[model samples]
Target: MAKLHLIKLSVGTETIESLRQWQAGKQTQTADGLPRHVTRMWPKRADELLDGGSIFWVFQGMVQCRQRLLRFDEVIGQDGIRRCAFVLDPAIIPTTNALKRPFQGWRYLQPADAPADLPAHRQTEDELPASLSAALADIGVL
Candidate 1:
């Protein structure tokens, strides 16, 4: 296990199920290296991010799912800014819901702080309403 990555989803694209669909769709496209996301800056800990790390996705302001980090590359934007292109594997692993505040950029997710992956049989709850799940997790009753 290695340190992970955390990213806030853009508005209207926050559901864990939606994330799974997105990952699936991306895989259907020709394998263009790895699935990439544009970011303002490249992570300094690229080695750590690629070392058996997963990207914890914050959906609807809560942690929902993760994807393995295949790699990260630097991409220069049209405006000449060097940006990070996070290359992620297509598999979206569900995780127990965890609350997170809105943030401007992706952050490092320590292995210890990242939520445990939901077991295959337990992934049914992934479709539950975020509010209900968050409340349950808050009380340690989820």
Candidate 2:
């Protein structure tokens, strides 16, 4: 089966570097030192997600980067509720800037719909302004 993916808004993040810095903190990582994103709902298709899937991050209204989903761990809050912790690879891969609307939570992203990873040469280029990127994406230029 084709690998599945998830897309979530990187709230409060202004750039990909900011997101990398934020995740670098110890508190944002699992006990084993992997980055993680805790969520209220566990994915029903965990197997597919674990089959080389990634968590695509939406920064400033555009899909900017992704981290591979390594595993799901169950975590309980002090409030005594169970939640899913998406243990992620530490490597943050840059992607072609794809425009996305504001959303409340993560959504499933099919392989066909996910943005392509930026070529290695382009990944080193200065990041484009969100508006310009969005306009390019809107015109299918991204």
Best by TM-score: 2
Q: Model 2, range 41-142, lDDT digits (tens) per residue?
A: 999999999999999999878999999999999999999999999999999999988889999989999999998899998888888888888888899998
The TM-scores of all predictions, comma-separated, are 0.84, 0.95
- Which tens-of-lDDT digit does each residue in 97-123 have in candidate 1? 787888887788889898888889987
Q: Rate the local accuracy (lDDT) of all candidates.
A: 0.73, 0.91
Q: Check candidate 2 and list the clashing pairs.
A: none
TM match of model 1 to true structure: 0.84
Query: Candidate 2, after superposition: displacement of residue 24 in Å?
Result: 0.7
Global lDDT for candidate 2? Answer: 0.91
Off by over 4 Å in 1: 10-12, 23-33, 124-126
- For model 2, what is the error of residue 126's alpha carbon versus the real structure, in angstroms, after optimal superposition? 1.5
